[model samples]
Target: MFLEKLASKGVTLAQLPIPVVRNEVERLVLSYAQQRQWFLWQMEPDGSAYNIPTALRFRGQLDLAALQRSFETLIQRHEALRTTIGEEDGQLLQVIHPCQPFELARQAVGTLDEGALQAQVALEVQQPFDLARGPLLRVKLLDLAQEEHVLVLTLHHIVADGWSMPLLIDELVSLYEGYSQGREVALAELPIQYADYAIWQRAWMDAGERERQLAYWMSQLGDDHPVLELPTDRPRPAQQSYRGQRINVDLGEALGLSLKQLVQRQGATAFMLLLASFQVLLHRYSGQADVRVGVPIANRNRVETERLIGFFVNTQVMRAAFDTQLTFSELLAQVRQRALAAQVHQDLPFEQLVDALQPERSLSHSPLFQVMYNHQTRVKGERRSLPGLEVESLPWRVHAAQFDLTLDTFEHEHGFSATLTFATDLFDAATIQQMATHWRNLLQGIVANPDQRVAELPLMDDTDRQHIVDGWNATQADYPGDTSIHQLIEAQVFATPDAPALVFGEHTLTYAQLNRRANQLAHKLREQGVGPDVLVGIAMERSLEMVIGLLGIVKAGGTYVPLDPEYPQDRLSYMFEDSGIPLLLTQSHLRETLPIPAGLRSLDLDGENLEGYSDANPNIDVAPLNLAYVIYTSGSTGRPKGAGNSHQALVNRLWWMQKAYGLDASDSVLQKTPFSFDVSVWEFFWPLMTGARLV
Candidate 1:
């Protein structure tokens, strides 16, 4: 073996035990399996997103043998590379092979096609790994052109995680350099293998530590576990498919600088600012006070575990309670406290914590939380430069999302990039894109105005706000200018004298006849000084006479207060008192029973002596801003309240209804609402205003 060859050259190598203990996370992973095959680590790559693949691009690579030897040395040094998980005595165990010959699959392409190479990498990442068989890791070498070569290393997540990638690459670079220059590679020996850490974790949790930790998590995540109500394009399926896609967004230079300054001012890191902003955004979208996000942590707290490469990554549920009254600065402080506490209690595996918390289990949703937040600080400046090769990390998609949404923020030399991975089954491309835009806008608002409350911060720019407000409500149209409701109706009477304007059952009044009849009533009303500022109570039933009385009051330059005759006598009396009307109009049949106050006089429309009154318009000088009508609220309390609207307000509303619903003379609107309610005012006038019949 290449490692044996290196050993013969006086290089000391560490040997792992034959069968070692599987870690706490490893055992939990085995429990996630649905079948015995999955328990044995026999994963079906098509259904699950468990594999971890990393690609490294190397330019001007000349020594293939030295590179191959470096990989072999890496496997010999780390027991994880030669490790495979299997079942023994009804328990999962990791078995490490003593040694094996190192082999790298070589593919030589004449032309350097980056797209082709990426496609190959994607296909390779999805390939299933046999956990019981050998070779849980694969190294594929692609020689593109002469000097450009790519080394793609794919490993199962059971042995590797995001935090282990850098360590693995750093060790590979050191071993490769030593082999290329024929110099001795002096690397420090690992104090313990991953198996030892696994054993220690199991024993430590079983001892009283787990109960203390579980109690903390239990209290943190209360009994009411609410799912995030993120608006999606499609309804959630009966079961989660884990099918996902990604949207990329960047934090621009200006905002990024401002965020950094804000972070410094708050005595926090950029990560804390990002997380706080993220929680604010989630709260705004979902309207939930308790927000829970799963954040992955590099669980390498001990000095010995820091240098070792294994699945040392753990997830911590970072929960923050948002209140609309809390300022952004206050929310950030709360987020910081929660994040620090979660980091302190990062030892409990996510699986074990789920078991302890015992939240309502659902196959359609993930346990505890559905949103994941991750921040990766890439060390681009500290990247090692090989002797004759230029090495750089290549981006590749490993698998779909395990959660409904995963927000990945990567810090680079210039600024930060945010990627939102959303499930395709639940969300559409445009929805996720809009979400990303809102995320950027939220960060900008936070950095610009950190003292603003989370609920007050603007999530949309001016253009977006305009589109929602002005663009959607762009219903302006020309109507009779400087016209009151009576003048507008009079104008319509002149234009369409014979058109049916008022209809009640089989009775129909033409525009001319309705105008003439209303004028006769108005002439009598003007005799009683029913002019501007005068309110006349029209306590009438739903009939044609009620419509004529309302029109006559408006025609006399006075606003009519609607008093429903069917209401209780006390309520009607309260409404009449609140309105303070000097005159009342009703049918002759109800005049005796109507609750007319002592000083208020009543005129029955059906019994009025209108034969002597002039059937001409009163010609009262009424401005568009004059009060049109007053509607009293039902006396749910002791006293009723009256709300008055001006003729201009009613005209504007009628114009909007005309434009919105396309009301015309052919349309018949039902006017069945009670007269005292505000909606009755619109119902009584909207049909007449737009030449529509009120049924």
Candidate 2:
């Protein structure tokens, strides 16, 4: 039925060639990465298929001939509109070729229900569009009355971003008005095509500009790359997934005025005030003296670029270190100065900055900043309406990204609204609710006494703060009264000894079988002279053996460093050398790939057991404070730095989870994450400690 309606509207797929210049190969590559291609298909690791369609809706009485003419002229004026992909000398490139005039159709609806028509338009617009194959652009018209109509346009992400929408709209309106009056068009010629800009960018980067930019980033991000230690009841995930929620906070007129007055007294702006408040909140919540966040800068400094549409946004990392002795006003001034300095040096792209700094990428978190703050002033314009038609702009839907949390603020007529978007998979609704309450309390406190020091502020007045502390200290009642991970595992050692405890791909390991294998590995490690204060490197693919190897090292009273097999050999060697690993555990299949130092002993975890060990064994006495594992995160030196954790920390986290979520052995958790990620740590140990089944 949908296809039939589309067919009646005269919409059809058109083939065109996308052109590219040969000299700008590097730019082409960069453009490929920057250009969004996810729209073409929705995919999962498992094969499932879906199609995306571009939808357009129109309202009011329409002039079909005039609209068609306007569209043709507009397409002819923009080179990108007629571009398609083609192969040149076995290389894919954008070919600039003319397309046949787009097919247009007119549909008459006798009914005059405005609300129903708007709903229908919204439904059509919500459909996804695939952009990888080609440009997915559509135009629709809705007749609201005999003299009025609405035009709806939809475009694929591959061809445009938010910046491009304004340009397209301006051009469309101008062209449509000219065609309607049958007058010769008067439009300025584009000085440069999108392709030219891409080529120029590549050339500019290759001409020593990129190196200078890199140097600046490296110096800016110094040593001691510390993470914001936000207390978490559960561990972090390895790979980021789309699971998020949003909360909106409105600042009333009085609060806004008070904030302005406070900022004026401190010689700063409202943005600085907000940033300072957030820094204090982060300091209190994360218990970190220093906090860093990523701020997006619109790179449209050039007058010409203000009109051109593209991805011209770059991220600036803002670092704020808080001391309890410093007053909020003083901190605001400092933040204002630093923010200005960052703005002066905002030419570097985030991706390029990452490559230059080469920070150690962590599975549990982003390489740089996890939190984002944005403040935008809306554009002013009067809404244009056709006769007998009322057109209103709809609120944009929230699109999830790979950040831990993002907050955006926009100036409203009366005051401002701060929208907080967070990952739902990592944070529950209760947590977000508390966050909102805490934010309001912080803002109110600052407004009440602008000269108050961050530590001197009355945080006790906030109920969420007390709630968080109470929740953090709460104890779980579902666990076996008072028992540790080792004690609980011992209790269930015989009951489910033969049941499958771990499965990966085609491989499965029973509880008894896994325990015996771990014991054998532990014995092997002991033979290799591994013990307390020693770090054992576990380098292998994501498999059941990898998990077994990690558990075994800890069981053997040595800390384990998880080495992702996908990491570059140089990086792997650096981590091994830096951590002073005396021994490594890996599969024989990857022996050639991971050639370690001659003195470092290596054992194959995948091969047959060299030591004859029985399942029955004397219980090993493991202490709660013993070293458990070392997780390597991003370092300022372009190398990974390992963060060591004690068994106490892990167990404390498990106990925190038990108290917070009431998880027990009866709960079955699907271990779908990799071990390198901290989130998997919870999924792996919490169940084992509570006698819970790990599916």
Candidate 3:
């Protein structure tokens, strides 16, 4: 009955035509339905309830009759205004429907107060529309006073994005002037409608065009997905959400022009200069030589799509490796070539690219890129208001995607302004503030002396560098005396024998108990023909036994190969076999999971026989130069290469930390990182050697 009534009102299935299909258009349609399902939804599938896009403003002493006439002329000039959607063949489609000009509804308010007028306008504009229905747009006007008025326009996302709003505003202004002057408006005929562009896009993509583009992307982003190693103060969430805040950094005209000149001298674009600056900053901040950042590309290569309103944006992962010795100009040249290559291969959709490259999607973040850099040079002209009215525009609501960080750059009249939006859940505001300051200093240094070598660029002022160094300096009276790591550990054990020294899942061991258990393990390894130069595998979970076993292997004059219990059985077996381990220390829980290679002796710390010897501490002597441990990080061949570290290296690190942080028994250091990560080496051993408490 509702369908019949709507049909009688000239809104029938026969009236609309299905829109042309394209990849982005199809994605947009599906995404709209999903958003409606999950987020904002208030209307049913009835054609009567619809949402409209509007721009609201106050117009003082505006003629009501003239405003009505202006709207009628605006509607007549733009065919999009008269277009409506209707159901056809069970799918919603757009139809050009005839309508009696724009209709105006006026309600008289008893009071002439400005606050009352705005309240009424807000109520009307806040009215929800059923986007699933045919009518998905609306406009309202509320008179605050005889001379003051508010204009509100609301529309569904299906019809527009940020790009289309400016177009609508430009046309509306011109139409208003023509209507007020009673003159025939001369407007250029659009070459094609948005639907036409959609059809063309589908045809182009179907002709093997996208496949070639995707091939380029794959080649550029190889197999290695380097992680951005930023130290986190808190445990990271399993997934990142789009909850962020913005920090705007202003680059004055002097600095901006200097940077432009520097890049130009190297025959590069300003983007190259900015990229080099960021790469250098990342290296200094994270102490990493390689960095990867996501760059957004406008993907509107086709002449047809330039004017077409749609979401035609794609992202490219850009990886930069820094050499501290390279000159600024040389780095800029390299960055220029790489950026050009990225632009040439920017056709692949970010989501599709990630899917194709990374088989393991369990990672907490995107494997390709976690940070984004957007350089948007386009800007819309300032809007002119209707006659007898002043207008002001402000963004009311906005939606952003999930990313660790995003830097949006726009060119202002004076210079460039970078608006950095970051996830608050992951980063503190102070960190972002420091990042901004660092970026400014880096850019200013480069701009001042473009010919200087990158190594020569002042990354930080001497005062700041000294401050950082001072914070790391560990020279205080409360600090423990210069003592060997082993001696320090022995002293702690003797001083606090009953204090808990190691805590793993479900098990906590006192220093005395840990020392005795480790000694027992060392004795067992010695009995199994293990000695100096032998690599014993600790194939166990993160438990008290794992820690004891590690110290025991070192104490007994043997290197420990940490075999993560979480690794696949095949990989674990391969590592143990490759390392030629003669003895393996593990708990009973993981015994069944591990493969017992030939000639590999196993000692289960949880077994009954080892329980009796747990209290027997064997004070074995080991040299600092003896092999302490071996860690296997990722390599290009999909195989892990072991980096052997001696006890001397561990001692050097501890000594460096002690000298750096002024460590004392009073300070508590948090042990937060996984043992598999290199950060654990410093977090765990530094405090133990310095007599500082490990929290």
Candidate 4:
């Protein structure tokens, strides 16, 4: 319809020919894309990671001769299908053979089941192609019955890509239809072949075009290629793995139309919108501001290579900066600007970009980007329906993960759908399944409210949120939430007064004995005017006396500040200044060597006389909000800093430990870590509060 209007207005669509390569057959250099494939083939010579297979089930009166002839005609038209790559002078070059008679191999299986037929298709896909040999494209036909047939077409990615598959399908249908009806082959003659385009591409790049495109890409992507730190179910392998799985997501017909309408309003292409949504999803999952996703462009802007079947795909990295303040509409604009610039400079060979950027080489991930995004306009197995056959597309999943994760979205007539391909080595199927749902939710949120912040967009539905927030966090157990940490120990003392509480080498203190001794020290601390909000420093080794000192200070309604005796004098002095402890509890043996600040009173616990103090719990009132303890950090930067926690918070942590680990009276937790480390707090108090011994 649009073409009719243009024709009436005297405006024709002109496809000017690209200059053809003249008689250049002797030394044909492989394109940069093909060279990259050759390098990959050398790395994995026996793997089918690069095989591209397409299968279809034909149920009708099948014409065997015309099917065979269609295969020959395809190979004859595209020289790359019959070509092989060979090495000479340290350069991988193309070896295009003359037109040869191609024969489609056929296999006869009597009434094979569905599973068996699928297995046959997978067998063809997994068979590695020998790039050094002649035929880069191969086909096989399986005869299930007199009227039912299955055609499997496999091509090495070196000679074909995602864009070339549809061209082969459309041409095969047309050619088979013509041949079956005994009509002449009506396909137009190509202006140039794949070899001619490869040669022309090299010539075009050598004349300063390479530098021009390289400058744009370098300025856009730069030398920095941050690996997208996607959370995985398992540890990543030391080397990359091709094992993968795929999941399909149906966005529904309404969502599909909404996406198209949203794109039209944003003044952006569908690719741009989907890419932006992908960036948003990645940013939310990774919590990263800089998100880099690799997008594959067809690289067929020129008319000459439009109909050719070859590997002409180029990858462009679309990097977006995200933040909580940026709106989705703002993000779309940013993506549009970057996407347009990328398309303008998309001709730079991805291999050359990798060489120039020189990102940190990794065997575990693809350089420059680990995530891939692609939108397909061509439907799989979509072709002209032949005269006498009902064609049904048979899915041939190569199950190879080319990248860490690749989201391939497809545009359909009434709706849109997507398939997520993920590396099984790093991700479980469930993880990828959630990721697909999250991506769809993100797209839905974007279409609903374009002005909302991208960070505010919903990536999950109610059920998913419920599973993560409520179901996984069902560790709720009743504990004394309003009580202080020391009060719990007192309750334990009442429940099992005769149980062993503290055990050191060659020493032990029962619950009753420990509470009575702590009471005596607590009375002495009260005489020193230590009350609520006061900080008393405890500097001592890990001994039975150390436990009494900490418990005594807290019982006197004062916060105990832990000072590791093993720390340097300078660090200990800084801790005293930061904590402002007017009283220091230490052993008499270290009084002479310790750095005691002037006017700071120091008491030796080992030498103090407590014969007259009452062996009863103190009567001080300490609320749950009162400061419990102050722990000084190592302060690797400069001076030490103290972090204070409330008694309520400390008790909550101890209670959680008991519920999580199910600690019982028979269990003994070894308190080997120093008092300064936070882990030691749980190690010290968890067992004490749960009727378990703390050793």
TM-score of each: 0.68, 0.56, 0.55, 0.90
| Reference-based TM-score, model 1 | 0.68
| lDDT value for model 2 | 0.64
For candidate 4, write residues 1-695 as lDDT tens digits: 32343355464444223444535345778888998888888888888777888888898898888988888888888887888998889877888888888777889876887788778888888888889995888888888999888888889999998889878988888889999999879687787777777766676676567899999888888767799999989888988768887888888898999999998998998889999999998999999999999999999998778888999999999999988799999999999999988888988899988989999988888899999999987676553467889777888554788888999988878767889999989999899888988988998899999999987999889998999899999977787778887788898999999999999998989988988988899899899989887999998998998998988898888999988888888888778887879899999888877788999988888989887999888868888788988887777886667888898889888777676789888999999899988777788778888888989
- lDDT per residue, candidate 2, 442-503, as tens digits? 88899998788888765545355556678766744443333335455545556777666666
For candidate 3, the C-alpha RMSD (Å) to the true structure equals 11.7
**Which portions of model 3 show Cα errors greater than 4 Å?**
1-162, 177-185, 226-235, 282-290, 300-308, 321-327, 341-367, 378-386, 395-401, 451-458, 471-695
TM-score (C-alpha, index-matched) for candidate 4: 0.90
Candidate 1 minimal-lDDT segment of 10 residues: 28-37
Best by lDDT: 4
Residue lDDT tens for model 3, 627-685 = 77777775458887777876766777676677777876567677787665677667766
Cα lDDT of model 4 overall?
Answer: 0.85
Question: Candidates' lDDT values, in order?
Answer: 0.78, 0.64, 0.62, 0.85
